[model samples]
Target: MTTQTSTQAQVIPKFGEQKKAFSIDKLKRLVNAAKSMSDFDQAKRYLCSYFIPCSNPHGVFMWRSEIKNLEHILDKNISKLICSITKVFYT
Candidate 1:
C-alpha cells in the first residue's frame, strides 16, 4: 500500500499602503475634538506635558490607572494615524 500527503499554501492580506508618521495637523484636529467634548478636562490632563497633582493620594493613584487605560486606547489609534499620514504623503 502507498500513502500520499497534500500540502496547501496559506495566503495573507496586504495593507497595500506604506506606513507613515503622524502629522501635526492630525494631532491638532484630535486635540481640538477632545477639547470640545465634556471629557476635555480629563483628556487635557492625560495629554498634558506637565504632571497634575491629585488632591488626595488615592486620587493620584486613580488618575494613573485611568491614564493607563486611556493610553491603551490611544496607542491603537496612534498606529492608524501614522499609517494614514504615510499613505497621504507617500502615495
Candidate 2:
C-alpha cells in the first residue's frame, strides 16, 4: 500500500505590504521632537511625512489633545479625514 501526503502553500507578503509594528512610545518621542522645533509648519510637514505611508501625504495626529491643534494647522476637512484614518489604524 502507498500513502500520499498533501503540502500546504506558503504565503508571501508583497513588497511594502507588510504591516509595521506600532509603538506608542516611539510616536510620543517623535511628537516631542516635532514640538521642540522652532517652526511649527516645517515641523508639521516633517511629522506628516513620517506618519504617512505609501504615496499620498496624510496627516496623522496621534493624540486626542492634538486634534484641536491640528484643526488650527490643517483645515477641518483634512482634520476629519486624518481623524478617521487614525481611528482605523488604532482601532
- Candidate 2: tens digits of C-alpha lDDT, residues 1-91: 2111111121222322324433345334334443223423332443443343322233333222323222222333444433321211221
TM-score of 2: 0.22
Q: Write the per-residue lDDT of candidate 1 for residues 1-91, one digit (tens) a residue.
A: 2111110121211221212322347334434444234424432333332222244332211112323321222333444533432212121
> Candidate 1 lDDT (Cα, whole model)?
0.29
| Clashing pairs counted in every model | 0, 0
Give the Cα error of residue 66 in candidate 2, in Å: 28
User: Which stretches of candidate 2 lie above 4 Å from their native place?
Assistant: 1-19, 36-91
TM-score of each: 0.20, 0.22
Return model 1's CA RMSD, one decimal. 18.8
**Which residue pairs does candidate 2 place in steric collision?**
none
